[model samples]
Each structure stands twice: as C-alpha cells, then as structure tokens.
Target chain A: MSGNNDYTQIDNLLREDRMPHIWCPGCGLGSVLHSFLTALNKSEVPLDKVSVVSGIGCTGRTAGYVKLDSFHTTHGRAIPFATGLKLANPELKVIVFSGDGDIGSIGGNHLIHAARRNMDLTVICVNNFIYGMTGGQVAPTTPLNARTSTSPYGCFDRPFNLPKLVTAAGATYVARWTAMHVRRLEKAIVEALLKPGFSFVEVIAPCPTQYGRKNRQSTGLAQMDYYKENSIIKHGADTKDVDIDLNGQIVIGKFVDIECPTFYDLQTEILGKTFPHMSKTQAEEASA
Target chain B: MSRDGQLVGEFFMNGDVASAEGAICAGCRFFAGYPITPATEVAERMAERLPEVGGTFIQMEDEIASMAAILGGSWGGVKSMTSTSGPGFSLMMENLGLGAMTETPCVVVNIQRAGPSTGLPTLTQQGDMMQARWGSHGLYGTIAIAPSSPQEMFELTITAFNLSEKYRTPVLIMSDESVGHMSEKVVIPPMEQIEIFPRRKPTVPVDEYLPFKADADLVPPMGNAGEGYRFHVTGLTHDERGYPDMTAEAQDKLVRRLLDKIELNKDDIIILEEDGIDGAEVVVCSYGISARVALLAVKAAREEGIKVGILRLVTVWPFPDQKIKEIAKKIRAFVVPELNAGQVVLEVERCAGGAAETILVPHMGGAVHDPDVILEAIRKGSK
Candidate 1:
C-alpha cells in the first residue's frame, strides 16, 4: 500500500497541542497509531465511515489522537460502546483501540461476548503487560511475578493470551504482533478490517515508564530489544499454548482463521428474509 | 388525533408489564435485560413480544451486559430498554454514566425495592429515589419520571422514550414493586395524540456533521453507527469538533451545557399536576404510589372543610422549583408523603423556602402509606 494519500492535506490528523502524546518517549504507541492511520489511509474505508472507540488507558488515548469518528468511553466499556456503534450502523467500520488493562481486565467480559456473538468489530489491543495509565497496576494480562506499582511484591495472577481467548470465544480472525513488527501489525489491521466477523489483533506494546521500570526494562530501546530477541514464530501455535519465563518463547502468528457466520450477516439474513423493506440497503443493492 | 383513538383505557397489569407495553408502543425494537424480582415481568413481556415484532431480545449474562447491549442496540439505530431493581440498578450505575456521557438514548426502568444491600427483593420500597438522580459519578443531567399507577407506567414509559430522543439523553422510568407487580388496567394511545420524538439526524451531508456540534437547540444531531456520518464521541470533555478538550474553560463550557440543556428547557421538561390549591392553607405533595395515597388524604381533608391541596410530580429530576415556590407562598404548610423515608422532600424544602412549614410522611418499605397517615399531617397543618 502506498504511504501517501489525502491525509497530508490535514498535516497529521493528530492534535499537535496534545503532543508529544502522554506515551513515554520511544513508546511504540506512536508507531501503532501511525500504522493504523496508514492502514486507514491506504484502505478504501472512508474517513467518514469509520468510528474509533477506546477505553481508559495510555493506549486508549488513541481515540483522542485519531482524527475520525472516535469515542473515548469509560474504562472497560469501550467494547460495549463500540458494539452499540456497530449494531446501530453496521456499515461503519467500528474499531476498538484499548490497552490490556482496559480490555483484558475490566473489559474482558465484553471482549469475549462481542467475539462470541461474532460482532463485526476490529479490536486492536495494545498489551503493555501492566496498566500504564493508572501508574502501573497489576492487570489481568500481567505476567506472573511481574512487578507493578500496585503489585509491589510482583503479580501473582497468570496473564491472558488475548488472541487465543478471542479465538476460542469465536472471533473469525485473530492475529498478534509486537511493536517491532510494524508491517505485520499493519497487515493484520488491514486483514481484520476486511473480514466480516470480530477481528482481534493484540499488539504487544512497550510501556517503558511503568511496566518496564518495575520489570528492569525501563527504556523503550531496551523493551524493543526484548521483543526483537525473545519473540519466535511458532507457525501454528494454539490459543491454548501458554508462554512461560520468556526462556524459549515462540510468539504465535495468525492463530485462528476461519469463516463463521457474523452478527452482521446473521442480521442481514434474518431481518432481510423477514422484514424485506426494513433491510433498506440490502434490498436496494439487490434490486439495483 | 381523536382522544378516543389514544384511549385504550385502563386494564389490570403490573407496573413492569405496563412499562414493557409502553416501550413496545414507543417503537422499541431491542430489549436486553436480566431477570430480577419485580422488574422480571418487563423482561419476560419484552422477550415474548420483541421476537413477534421482528425485534431482537437477549437475556444478558448480567445487569452490566444488559445495560451494555441496550446501549449498543441503540447505536445500532434501534430504540432499546432494560429493567432492573435495587442491586441490579447499583450494577448499572457505571455504564449508566457511559450512556450519559456518550449521549446515547435508551430507557432504564428501575422498579424500586428495599435495599442498602438487597434488603427486600420481592417487596416494594422507594429507597432508590435519590440513587436514580446521583448514583453515577461525575457531573451530568438525567431524566427520571415517576409513575403512580399502571396507567401512568404505560403513559410515562412512552414519555421516557420521547424525552430520551428529544434530549439525546438517557431517561429512567422509576416505579416500585407495588406498581410494577400490581395488576391494573392501562390504555395505549393512538397515533395522533400520542406524541413521539425521534433523534435528530444530520441534514448537512455526513462529513459536515460534527457529532458534538452544539446546535441552536443545544442537542447535536445524532447519526447512528451505520448512517455513514462518522463522528467521534467521548466520555472526556470534548469541544464542538468532537475532539477531547481538557482545559478548565472547555470543561466549564461543556459541563455547563450538559446541565443547561435540561435546566434552561425546564418548562418543556418539568411535569407537575396541581389540584385544589386555590385557597388551601396546607398542601400535600407526593409521587408514584404515595401520590395516590396523598390524593385520598386531600379528598378527606376537603370533606371536613379543611382547605388542602395536592401537587403530584410526574417529572422528578428538574424538581419543579418554580411551581413549588409559587405554591409555598399561599399554603401555610407542605406535607411530603413518600414510600421512602425522605428523598424528594429535601428538594421540596429547597424549593419551598420558608414560605411554608414542611412535613414528612415517611414509609420505610413493604406496604403502601395509609391515607390517614397523610390526612393526619394535613389535619395538623390546617389546625
């Protein structure tokens, strides 16, 4: 995809005043944001036909920065809000941008449910392991024994394999990529957007200030080094495959890719067959 | 519109059933709720009826999901609602704020039941009166209507939808178990006389519609998820451009307008009915089932040649300050009879000033207040 488009006419859709964003220097959130905008810029998705929704966290701030239809909703409820937006108007490309703490913890239930229903939404979760915005609290996806401000003695809870969870929960498309894999991340987003069901992409982002400081990887460069060295492509890793110690970890690729009936499709099928006039677009398009 | 067309007349149904029918008549295509006592009938009725109307009905995992799904359904461009009581209402407070901040229009029915923590699930209580107004954190305006009977439940439930769309804000239909579970008759209105309000749609082409643009009416036009008018919405304070603005000036401007939409439009929003107050020395003010009890008290007092009146509040949130202030001057005493200890009475005191002496006819929970309890207060006030 070409990097250039009508985006330059706006001189970066980001709020220059809100910049340098609250994300720590060298944090991958900026890159993720860039890649997302580029994806939107490259794809046929109209700027006016997209709604970006986010929950509370550093990554959740993506909605604030993105110059599009965005909703910076309450913590853990962005998925529900996005679901509402999607159901309200299925034609709009509803994407959920949230942090691990917001999605895997407070919003975990919504995440799984939206997936189970095969709701047509693309969820881009920035997994920084710990809750960065709230001063590094131990989150649901925090690795066992990983230290955080809240977990002074290190976290005891096991981390969630987000892609795996969604895959099992019935997401049609599931993929994961680290901050270092910008191209892959962009590709995953493009693929997710093109798919008809719940598409989930868990980006392992670096929170150098909070999650990193406590875990002895305080610098963004250091965190990037960890991703570059530690991640391995298992080719066909299962959602049930657990990562431990990072001692010989093989990071998964596209874990789940299958065709399932999506909420939009089901709605079109049921409502179209029943209330022919109510399916305005479908009837018109069909007749046309 | 002929009055007879709208007059289905009253029949025997519980408050919850009345609310459900009202929702259906209001063009609600989606119903998402969990089964809790008192409010269960609303869900049951919705489940049976929504499917028949070719609408969607889902029993969510919990109250939180129920609230979430309805909010989602509304954005999906369908009118949606949910019902709950005490503990369930408490669970909904967080997402309720989300609905408020996002300016999503949906209906929430809270059938009052006793509680500090699940005090009485099956029995009736008006304890949640205050919680309905200020339960959610942060500053925002809410619309809550109280219904005195199954007839009012049917009527107000529709009114709640109208207000929700007109204001682009969530509206609550407050009822107690007594009204919710009791069997009574209600009339569904016909097309013309029964007013309906739909959310304002963008007319200035999709791209030009700023989702948060404060219009002449103060409500920004709402373009649902699929309408192709992509606009941003956020819980954080945002400018008219729909982008987050965190400055104090921005917060002040945004929050002020959030309150001002209802505040400045009080005449259009506030609903109160005054009875026999022309020369009354004392007045009885009540709402919901208690209002019915207070009416009987006023009638009995009038029979004994006591000058008394009744002010029944239908819209409780804007608080009818002007009406209360005006009535306070002529009436020497004001008696508030409520199913709860004393919730709305405080607002009455605020609005009444010192023009009239205030009295509280408090009922803890369970049974309804007797007319004599309120009548005695009226008799004492007259003496």
Candidate 2:
C-alpha cells in the first residue's frame, strides 16, 4: 500500500473505494464516522474480532463503509442482530450504529431491552432528529412542532429522550455529543469501547438536506453554530434535564457511568453455579 | 450421554421436545425464540437442553427479533434457530426475507397454528403453506420441510439445519400444532452416526474472499464474523464482493442465483414418501398433519377396491414439481387433503397441468380432516 494514496490515517480502517459516501453535502455523518474510526484505532480493539452492525437510514450506511466485519441489517433490527452476534460468539465485540428513527422509533423496544438486559454492545446512535435518507420525514426524536414532509402542520407528539430512556433501561455507560465535538466524541467512544455492558453514545448530527432545511438550520455550518452557541457540558447531570428542544440549549456530556453486572457476568455467575460443567462459550451460560 | 446432550435411548416425548433435541444433535448452539401456544414447548425444551449441552437459548422480545438474532448467531460461528407459531411466524416474515437475502444459514421452526389474525391459537392448521412459500416480499426461493410426527420432527429438525447449512439460507420446518403437540417415541442415534453437515467454510483467502460469490455448488462458503475476513452483507441487492449494487442487472444476477442455488439443488433438497404411486388410479397428496389423516383415508379407499396411493411430502418447498408432473400422467385424479382451504394444492394443480383432475379436501382449522372425508374424496377420484 502506497502512503501517497492514503489520504488519512484511518483510511486503512475504512472502505475508501465506497467513498464519496451517500451522505449529502454538509451532513454530519462524515464527521461522526471519522471519530468512530479514530476511536476504533486508538482503543486498539482487534478489528478482526469487531463486528459493526447497522439498521436502515443514513446513519445505517456506516456498516457498509466500515472495513470491519459488518452487517447492514433490516430497518430497526440491528440491536437484535448484534445481540445474537455477541451472544453467539462471546469473544467478538459488537457495535450497533444507526439513526434516530431506526433506534428510537421502530427499534425502540429492542434498544430498551438490550440496555435492560445489559447486553455487551457499544451502540452509537447518530441522531439527526429527522429521517434524512427518506426525504426528511419526521422522526421519533424530532422536536415537537418541528416541520417535516410528514409533519407539515408541525409535529404534535413529544420526541423521545434517548439518553434518559437508555439510562433508565440500565445502560452502564451513556453519553451524548454533537458532531462538532469531534475530539470529545472520539474520546467518549474510546471509553465506551473499553467499558463493558451496554454502552451508548448518541451523536447529535446535522441533516442539511432534511432536518436543517425543514427546521431552518439550513446549512451544516448553521447546525454547528447552533451547537457552538447553545452547547453546555455538565457531566453527570440528571438525564431528565438533557432533553433538547428546537433551538434549545444542547446539554451534551456523559450522563450515566456506573458499575453493573453485565449480561455475561450475570449469565456466568448464575449458570456456572447451576450447570457446574457448562461450557465456557457465551450461550453455555444461559436459559430460563 | 457421551454426546453431551444427545439422548440415544428411546423416549416418549412430544414433537416439540424432539425438535429441540434434534437441533442439539444437529450442532445448533444458539436458539432464540418467543413463547407462543403449542410451539412454546419447543422453546421450553430448548431452554432446558441448550444450557445442558453448552448452547445459548434466549427468549427474545418477539419473533422478528428472534429471527434476526438467529441470523446474527449463525454469522457469529454458531448454528442458530428460532421457533414460533402462527402470529410469531407472520411477525418473522420480514427478517426471514432478510435472512434469505443475506444468504445466512439458520433454521426457523414454525409450529403451524390457525391464523388469519390469530384464528385458532390453540388448534392445528396447515394454513401457512403459502405464507411459508411466498410470505417474504421479494421473489426468493424457500426451502420448507413438513414433519408428520414426533419421530419425524426429531429426524427432520436435523435435516432442516443440514439443508440450511448446505444452501447457506434459512430453512423452515413447517409442522402443525397437532404434530408439534403429539407425543411419541423418538430414537436419537449416536452423534457419530447422524449425518451432520457443517457450515461451508470459505476456501479462498481473506483478500480473495467474496462473501456472496457462489462456488461450484452455487453456494459461497461462509466465513465467521471475527475471522479477519471482514466481509460485509446487506439486505439490499449486492454484488459478489458483498457490496451493494443498486441496479436492475445486479438485482437480476443476485436474485436469480439466490433462487437457483435452491432450485438447481431441488433434487437433493426435495424429500417425498411415495407408496403405490407407480400404478395408482388416484393419488392422495398431502403433508404435515393432514398427510397423517390422508394415509388412513387412502388405506380405507384401498379396502373399498379403489386403486389409490399416498404421496406424503417430506420436503414441501422446491415443491416436488418433477415428481408431481410425472405422476400426473398416469393418475386419474390428485386428492389433496390439507387443514387449510387450498395452499399446496395450488402447486399440485400447477404441476398436474390438467393431466389429472385436482381435488382439494379442505379443512378450515380447529381440527384435522376426518379420514372418512379424505377416503370419500379418494374413492370418488379413483372412479
């Protein structure tokens, strides 16, 4: 491999030929993917044993671009797929990356349950607050009264407080950061990668063509400026206080970081005692 | 006992339990499912056995997740499976389609129940024959097996995993609630004796590996997720390299091959039980629980001096088209007895091609057809 052809340090970690990605102009997914690859590099997690999974949406495209063992599964089904992957092969580290609509809406049940069961996975939810791939439809995380193709009259329903939901559902590690905080995003991902149990880092990204255009933050810079002006980092704040409204102060920080027996720990503890001669694989210590 | 979880001695067990044991014997190490009537025993049995035999059994939130997880498990270097009844089966269709598209090797056991919206949750029905064949959105070929009894359930669950592994696609065991609930003797042989088909591991090196590229047998060997293969698979149409190629040509190539893998191998995949079909005037064609009923009916008709035969479909999908067409030439009529109105009969009729009269002995759930009803149909068909 010629160093001259390698454009970036993390180029080895990505499918460069697949780039010029599908994310539109000024979309924040590019920055998010960069930070993710950076984290994967710095953490030194064996890329061979790392399987990246994603659901449908713009963010879901991350699985395809990653040079790791990847699976671009059906819409809203990435969590379950990752759960199976991790459980079936306890040695592999599974990561789920998808959009707000994919994880917060259609896959809401799976998201909460994975956290509840404390499945060993690092979930990176790229929340642009709109379904950018499908022409900017209203998302579950879209602010109430936000304009979208579907919510033309404005969204009447309240949006999901993702951080609060996952924390309550029992995530051992949880954090939120916008795309502008690339360094911090990369750091948090590294931390989440190191931490076992269900680790979630929600990356608030920009959808220039969709959410930004509809919600009046039309350009990618506009969304970054909003982040620049309104962002407040208060570590360990009450998750309930982190809900972001339209043009609201973006409370971005590590919200929940605690110790808990993960799905594997509990499985081993409980099953090892009962089935004295059980196998050492992930599924060996399971049942009900 | 030496086989760890394989029970070789004769034991009276329900078909559901036998299936769970069969999965264990067939090298399935991961099971994920949700509880549903009649089929719940399969999950219950799996829960007890998987832990004992060093496998994973998870009760997922629902069937869709159950199906998705199994696919994930399969890629994670374990043979995986999920079992459900009617409602759960319908919920699983989307992911099942995804499983087919990605060519993931997994087994889905749908213990048939009455449905059209939970029609008869506690009862048996062969209602999902068409759904099993065409429930998924796109045009993809399906491999479905119909187990008639507890013994067959134990035997065929192994076959389902073997077929799924051989083809690198999800295989369905379409047994009804009656058969799923029936208790009978299931003799599991020594593990060394059972023909086990391991996952086809990729022969090519990592850089040269194309995850979706078919080898000589039209099935690309699979490489596990963490093996440095670093391959990608998607629900979208993809090329040989496992990268998405959004074009009509790409779709045509992928779908046709995804289909031809099973279609071309139909002779190897299709299993049928034919008795007296060589010179019978009328053929009693059936599968699953209905086939059990059709057998007695055929016997009764024979006593009445009617020339009839019994053709029980063991492998329901890739539907014994050639065999059906061949039999149609000599038979006066084909008597199809299914718990549903007419599902597989349509395929029988299509294969028969007006060569023989096609008669459907239909039952609309809650119960199996009486032998007398099928007997009357067979007697009339022969005349």
Candidate 3:
C-alpha cells in the first residue's frame, strides 16, 4: 500500500469510501476541501494532532469527509465545540470549518467570543453568500439586494464584513480568498494553521445550485470567472473597506496579523500567580 | 498531584456545591455551563475548584453553547458536565439531542425550579421531570436520577457521571431548588471506595475501528479527538462507520440502538427504594423532595392503622416500571404526591395497568407538598 500508484495524494486525506460526496456537480466546496487538504499536507503540524469541527450546513459536511478526528456539531455551535476541544487538550490543533449562515448568523456570538478570547483555533469560513443546504435561504453574508428563497423580493439587510468582524473581535491573524484562488487559499490556510492565536480565513465560494443560479452567475464556471475578474489582491487592506457587493470588486488578502497572549496563556498566568505554592500542572488540575 | 485523592472528606454544604464536588470525585475534568439561579453555585464551585485539580471549567455564552462544549469536551477525552435550571435547560434541549444522537458521554444537572417560563427562580418544583425525559426532540431513551437531599445530591451526581460513561449517553441529575439550596452533611467516601466508570476506548487499531460500532453491551468504544483514530461524529443518522446514511432503514437502526442501549439496560439503570411495600394496601410513589415529604405522609397513615408503604424513586427515568408492576399486584392503590400538578404520576398510572388505582396528590409548584395532604391521599387510597 505504501508505493501504490492507485491512490492520489488528496485521496489519502479523504474518506474514499464515503465518496462521491453529496456536493453538487461543480460545487466550490470540493475546491475548498482540496485547498484544505493541500494546506494540511504542507503544514508542519502532524495530521493526527488536528481536529476539525463544523456546524450544520453544506460546508459542515467537510468534517465528515476529512479522514481526521472531526465533529459535525449542532447548528451554530462549531466554534464553542472547538473551543472546548482545544481547551480540554491544548495539544490538539482545533479548526472550525463551516458555512456563512452557520458561522456568521446563528453562530455569530460564538465566533466573536472565541475570537475575543483569542482562543487558539483556526476558523475556515466558506462564504457562499446564501444558505445553500437549506435551499438558498438569505444568510448574514447574503449581499444586499440579492435574491434568495426567503428573500424573493431581494435581500434588503446589509451583509456582514467577516474580516472586519474578527479583526474587531481580536483575532491575531485574518485573511480572505476565493475558492477559485486555490493556491492562494491553500497558502492562507497553511499560514492560519501555523499562527499562534485565533486565526480566521474567509473563503469566498460559489453555491451554483443555490446562490449562483438565483443571482445570474448560473454556472460554477461563470462564478469562477466572476471571481477571477472581480477579486483584487489587497494585502494589509482595511477590513472595514472590504464589504463584498454583488458582482463587484472582491477585496481578498491577509488583512491582520499581530501577537497577543491567548486565553490559555492568560488563564495559566492568572492561576499561577493566584496559587504560588502549586505547580503549573497542579493548578490547572485543581479544577478537574 | 492526585486530585481524586484529595476528594475524600466530610463536609456540610449545599446540594449545588456537593454536586460540583461529586463531579470532580467522579473523575469529571471538564465543566461548561451558564450561570442560572439555584444551579449557579455548581458553576461557581467548579470555576473555583476545577483548576486546582487539573481540570477545565468554562462558562459559555449560553446553555446551548455550554451543552455543545461538554459534548466536545467528552470527545476530547474528558468526563464533562453542565448544570442549569429551567430556562437554561430549555435552551440546552437541541444540543442535548445532538449528544444523544452522537452517543457522547456527559452529565446535565438540572436544579429544577418552578416554570412554565421561569415562574419561580428560587422556588422548588419537579415541573421539569417530564421535560428531562422528553425535552430533546426525538424518540429516545434518557437517564435521569432524582436526589432527595444534599447528601443524595453528592452521591447521585457521581452516579449520573458513571451511568453516562457506561451507556455513552447524557445523564440528567434531576435535582430541584429545595435540595439544591439546602445545606446538609455530605460524606465523601475515600476515592477507592467510590467506583468510577470511565468511557470505554477502542481496542482495535485506527484502521479497523468503526466510530459507531457497538459491542454486545450496546455501547461503542469512544475514540478521543486527537488520538489518531481519525473518526467522524455527526448528529445525523449514521452507519457504524459514522458516515451519514439518510434512509429509513438507517434511521431505524441508529435510533433503535440509541433507545435500546438504555432500554435493554433498564434493570441496571432503574434505582428505587421501598419501605413496608410488601402486603401493603396502599403505596405512596414519589421522588425528589416530594419523596421525603411522602415518607412522612406514609408514616402518618401507618400511625392511623392504615397499611401504607413508600416507594421513593432515585432513578426517575427508566421509570421503575417493573417494580411498580410487581408492587401493583399486591397493593390496592398508589398515591403519588409531586410538586408539579402531575408528571411522574402518569408514569405510575401507566405502569399500574389497571391492576391498582393511581391517585395524584398535586401541588402547583413554589413549595413541597404538605404531609397531611399526601396522608389524606394515602388514607383515601387505603379505603
């Protein structure tokens, strides 16, 4: 099995028996998974040490396909679940991979709080603009005036600028890339994986079956072309200035990177100072 | 260094505090909860003590997140628990179903208070008894243990953790506000004397392991998140391999196993205490604080030369149906007194199966039953 030519590199990281996956033909989720696999392969962290968590949605299925310790948690709960996983075993590299509605709308509170605490988690959010799995419901990331199942008249609410949300919430590292930018997205993922504190990467992906068809980008290829034409690589750009518009210029780049003490570090420091007589492990163990 | 060793001692404390200590003694190392009245002391105690014992205590944004965190913590290879009262318990229902579906081992302590919607935050009520059994949406079996006093709260919380680990399901410590806030002497036995059931881990190598495959005992060996087992856990109906299988057949198989894991083990899970039940004319059935009150009523009835017995339910769910059936054959009737208008009495009535008359001495929350009222019911049942 070691020298087998039958298996592809990406295939080694996937649950081959579980494929072909549930994703529609030409869905951007496939590309996102590929980029994640590529990044995992490139990173120095051991695959065995990685744990992936996801909330309910089309993207939530990513945890099921990945041949790693993964949790397909309840809707709007991936971040908190990952927080618990990481805090319980600090050695594990916990990552939350879910859709826009999952991470931005219902789970928005956890996202901000996890980022605010600077919990060491890698959050890879696939922003498909609409809630694809629930049949194209309007999401928090649905661009203004966009058509959705719920918003047949057009979405009137302004969409959240995710990079700005996490930046303000105190994420140490943040970046954005399109699913079509496979190489760049993979690189961003690798960088996010290696970063110390809470890191977030927003991947702008097409939901051809849901968002794309409803909005006039009809085919996955058409959405990819739009991404290619509209995306502007703006490293160090202000997150607040990167709000996406329908078929408009998509500002994509690494926007924030800084150093700060994480939740675990601060907690340890406080416990150590408070209990001077106890060893670090003992102090940590006292709560168990 | 050994936190478990430090747990052996006697202390006079409230039920909520004793419960937190019980969780630690039971080898629970992770606690995630939101602070709610009556149950908040459990979280406060955990926050103060967990770090000292090499454990983790996290106060999540809400009960929903708290429930999710404990499930994640369990998968991360820790015995996890969370506590809440009525409102927070309601918020935790959805994720509680997820825990059941995924077969995660964790404990949920509901220091129950009066509620249709937070009617009485500081008052005692067994109103959430039915909710604990069926709060989470689905047809599933659940384990809930009722503790009558602070000492029982300490003892039964450990039982809750042990049962959760053994069955790989969420166990509920269905304590009420009266017991939660009341102080009493609780003796923590030496660590070695207390039996703790740790989750079963897969013996097979990573390649051969199936995440949802159950042994003859109807429980799957759990694989920790970062242990290289690389298993997938989902709330969706899944095959033994843990991959989603959305078919009626798959749902039937998965749901049945989830139910059977506890149902088949019902004999072991049901815990009840009885006094003077043999050859009794009337048996008073009750649980939680009401059980203590019912015992006094039984004593009053017996003093009046009435043949009455007391059936105290320690494990409220898995409902002691067999015991009720056996006792119903010899008894003329059952008198159930509860804080709620009617809850567990329905279960007693169902199990009696017309062999005996079932009477409910109802109380509309905010207080325990007056012994005279239950005594009246016992006297009525005897006649």
Candidate 4:
C-alpha cells in the first residue's frame, strides 16, 4: 500500500458538491473530512467497498460528498442506517459522520445502541457546540451558558460530555482531538478505520461563523489557536478532569479501552451452539 | 401421473404457524421479529424451524429493529423475514421506506388486527390495505398479498419471498387474525417440488461490479456483504454506483426508475383468481379472510338463482387493475367485501371504469360479516 504522505489520490475522492463545504473558513470539519479521505486513500480501502452514512445538518452532507456508497439519512438516524449497512454486508467499511445535533440529540438512542452492540464501524462526530445549518441554534453539546438562537437566555442545561457518554455506552475505542490537531486527528481516523469494533473520535471543531461569533471568540483562525493552547498531550486523562467550562477542566484524551465481545461475535457464538454448522459462511457457500 | 395423484398432507394450526411454515418452505432462513399478538406464532415457529434448517432467528428490541435487522440479514446473503401486526407494522414504516430506497429484498408479514390503534389484538381486520401500499413515506411501489387459508398462506408466503427476490423489493403478506388463528390442512411439499427464488448475484468480476447499475432488467445483480464485491448503498437518490449525488437530474433519474421498475412490469407482479362470471351480471371481489366468505357467498348466490362471480385478489397491490377492467366489461356490477370500513373497495371502484356499479361490504374488529350480507350485495348488484 502507498504511504500516507501522498495526498494526490485523496483529492480524487473529495466530493464535488461538498467542494466548498459550509464549515467556517478554518473550521475543523474540513480538516476532518480531509483526514478521512486521506485514511481511505492511504489504506487503499477501495472507494467501492466503503459506505459512508451521515445524518441531517452541515456535517451530514459528508455522505453526499463522499465518493462511495453513502446514505444521507434523516436527522440523528445515521447510526441505525450504518448499522443496517454493516450488518447486511460486513465486508463494507461503514463510517458515520455528523454534527453534534445529529449524533447527540435526535440520534442519541441509536448512538447508545450502536455503542452497546459494539458494531464494527467508525463514528466521527464533529462537535461545533451549536447547530450551524439551522443558523446557530443551541445544541445538546453546547457549552454551559453559551448563547445561541434557541438559548437567548444562555444555555442553562449542561452540555453532554460525548466521550464519557460513549464510554459508558460500551464503545470499545474512544478518542478526542481538536481541529488544529490535524496530524493527530488523521491518525485517529486511520486507527478507527482499522479497529475491528466500534470506534468513536469526537473532533471538537470550531464554528467561527456561528458559535465563535456568538461566544465572542476570535475568527476561525484564532479558534484554532485556542484549541492549540487548551489541549494537552496526555493520552490517559481522567474523565472527571476533562471539562469544557470554567474552574478546572482538562480537555480529555484517550479515556477508556476494553475488550468486551461485540454483538455479532457473541451472536455468532450463540448461533454456533444453537445451530451447529449453520454459520453464515456455510450458508453462503451452500447457496452459491 | 404419480402413484399418489392427490398428494396427501394435513395439519391443524394457527395463522402465524402456517405463515412461518410458508416462509420455511420458501427458503427463508433469517428472521427478525418482536412478538406481537396474532403474529407471534410466525416468530415462534421460525425460532424452532430456522435453527433446524441451519437458519438464524433473532428477537429484536422492537419492530423498527426487527425491520432494520431483516434488511441487514437480507444484504448479508440470506432470505430474511419479519412478522408483526398493525401496531408493529406501523412502527416499521420508516425503515420500510429504507428497504424500498435501497432496493433490498425481504419479507414482512403483517398479520393485521383491528386498529386505529390496537382496537382488538386478537381479532381480525384488513384496515391496513392502503398502508400496505403507501404507509412508507415515499414514491416507491409495494407488492402485497392477502392469503385466505392456511394452505394459501403457506403457498403465497413462498410466492412473496420469490417476488421480493425477483424485483429486489419488500413483499407484504397481509393476513388478518381470522386466517392467522384458524387452521386446516396444508400440504408440505417434497423438497424437489418446491420452487425457491434466490436473489441475482453478480457475475462480473468483483472490481467491475456496480451494485446499483441496471441491466436489461431494472434490477442490478446484488453482492452479499463480506464476499469481496465491494459496493456502496445509500438512501439518497444515487447513480448506479450507489454513491449519493445531490442533483435534480440524479433524483429524477433514480426516482423514475424506482417507480417505473414496478409500475411498468405490473402485469408480471399482479396475481388474482376469478370464479364463475362466464355470463354473470354481478361480481364480488375480496381478499384475506373475507375472500373465504366471498367464495361461500358466490356458491350460495348461484344456488339462490342469482348470477354472481368471485374475484379473489392474490396480490393486493399493483392492485390488479387490468384484470378488474376486463371483468368490468363482462359484469354489470362489482361488490367488494373487506374487514375494514372501505379500503380495497375504493380501488375496485376506481379501476372498474365507471361501467360497473361497485358496492362496499364492510366489517369491523373481531367480526366476520354474515355471508347473507354479501349475498344481499350480490342480489342488489345482480338486479
């Protein structure tokens, strides 16, 4: 396989409509999409074998852009669609990309279920703190007291700690990185793609046009600077220490990793005992 | 002829068990269903027989999961099925559209009960006739079958599986509680005589295969997951490669084919049975449990010095319009008897071309219409 350094092939995989994305001039979503295409290109995972699934919102358009088998589904429902796709043809590499609104709010149940099932796929959630497509509405992952179209009185509800949520929901692999950490984000994407079970990487991207302007942050470039200043290099940070608000909060790194059996693996085990020699492999061969 | 020309088989069973036996005989090996009344027997029987035949059965969390799981199982290279009643079938609509858009082949058995919402769990009604055709939110077509007996349930279940595979669309087996709970003799066919429909597999090299590229037939050959024929699938209107493209042109092309694939070939997909009516002035059209009663009414009407014929719709959707039109010219009037207030009756009227007078004979939850009520409609239409 070719090395990751050559990004020329990645250009071929970028979607045309998704060309000038809706992200802020320097928004991390672009970097994430770039890194994603890079991983697929570098891994030489044939574009034909990949099926990208996304939900409604700005990031949801990734499905439309990706030059592969993609499902641009309804809001927050991308996981279920991806779950169906992966379960149907385990050979297809299923990846889900969406915004916080898509993943944490409408699709929250599917996220938890997919995590618990430990489905073999990758989930890339671009956390921009607020809904961008609906013109900066307060999102489920919006920071405490953040101002937005929906939360004029400031978001009173505490936002979700997404990594912690998935960790508790039984995701086998969890990682977090900011938009400015392009190399780290790209590596995470590559690792998640290779992981045999459910892998989640919550990329904290900056919506300079919406959240950044409302929160009184600098331009998109300056927001990238904040990500650089705030993030620490520790890979094993405690969940309690990672915080997105005032007082003491460390932007957490890799938190939990366990080896619980995935839904399909355990499913095949029960099936093997219940119906000996009825494995899908045998059935497919016989049918052929 | 064979030594046993009549061919012997008989058993007392409920509607759900009969449907499950039908699926098994049809070569269905993957089942995902959450237990619901009047439909639970189908799932239970699958749990028992699917294992014996080296097939798999899963109890999903809900009907939505059941629908999604079956879609997955189908793509995973198995003939998959799910059974539910009205409430569960209602929950399955969203994903049912998903199956339609993705063009996945699977069987969904709706053993209908009385309901606006769970009106009668143990009773029968055919209220979901329209839902079976248009419950999903989209412009896709559906193939629905209404079986009147345990024997037809077994036979049509196989036919549903075969049609679904042939067209790469979801097939609906709409059975009411009356037929689901009732039992009579159903012959179990010998293995050699049973006809099974397998989905078309890709014959081209793995690299050359495009999952959604249509051949002479609108259906492209499908490759099972994990078999190395890598292809993408999506819910968006997409090109033949299964990649999402956001353009009016793309949507127009894709949606047209999705609608045309079934519409253009309606003749190949529609199935109905006709009785009497060579020189009859009136005809009765019905399906499911009502068809059984209609059959009896047709017999009784003839004995009572009235000329009446029966038109039994084996395939409820694609709605048998051409057959109805042909019969309309021969008959002076049409009578449709159904468990619902009026569903298929409306379709019968629309397709009868204003030539035949169409009358609706409606029944509600848990109630089977008296044969005399249909006889009256026949009498009125005959005159």
Q: Give the per-residue lDDT of model 3 (tens digit) for B118-183.
A: 699999899999999999998788999999999998889999999998999999999999999999
Off-target runs (Cα >4 Å) in candidate 2 are A1-8, A277-288
Candidate 4's displacement at residue B219, Å, is 3.3
**Regions of model 4 farther than 4 Å from truth:** A3-24, A37-50, A67-69, A89-93, A190-196, A232-234, A237-243, A246-250, A278-288, B1-12, B202-210, B224-230, B243-249
Task: For candidate 1, give the lDDT of residue A133.
Answer: 74
Per-residue lDDT tens digits for candidate 3, residues A1-288, read: 113432226776799988888999768999999999878877757788899999999999999999889999999999998988888888899999999999999999999999999998999999999999889999999998899999999999999999999999999999999999999999999999988789999999988899899999989999999999999999999999999997899999999989888787777778878665333542255356
Name the candidate that leads on lDDT: 2
TM-score of each: 0.91, 0.97, 0.97, 0.88
lDDT of each: 0.81, 0.92, 0.91, 0.80
- Candidate 4 share of real interface contacts: 0.29
Per-prediction share of native contacts kept = 0.57, 0.88, 0.77, 0.29
In candidate 1, what are the lDDT values of residues A15-52, reduced to their tens digit? 56556677778688988887777667656576667888
- Of candidate 2 chain B, the 10-residue stretch with the lowest lDDT total is B1-10
Between candidates 2 and 4, the TM-score winner = 2
Q: Which tens-of-lDDT digit does each residue in B30-69 have in candidate 2?
A: 9999999979999998888888888988999999899999
- Show where candidate 1 strays beyond 4 Å: A1-20, A41-47, A244-250, A264-288, B1-12, B52-54, B203-208
- lDDT: the better of candidates 1 and 4: 1
Better candidate number, 3 or 4, judged by lDDT: 3
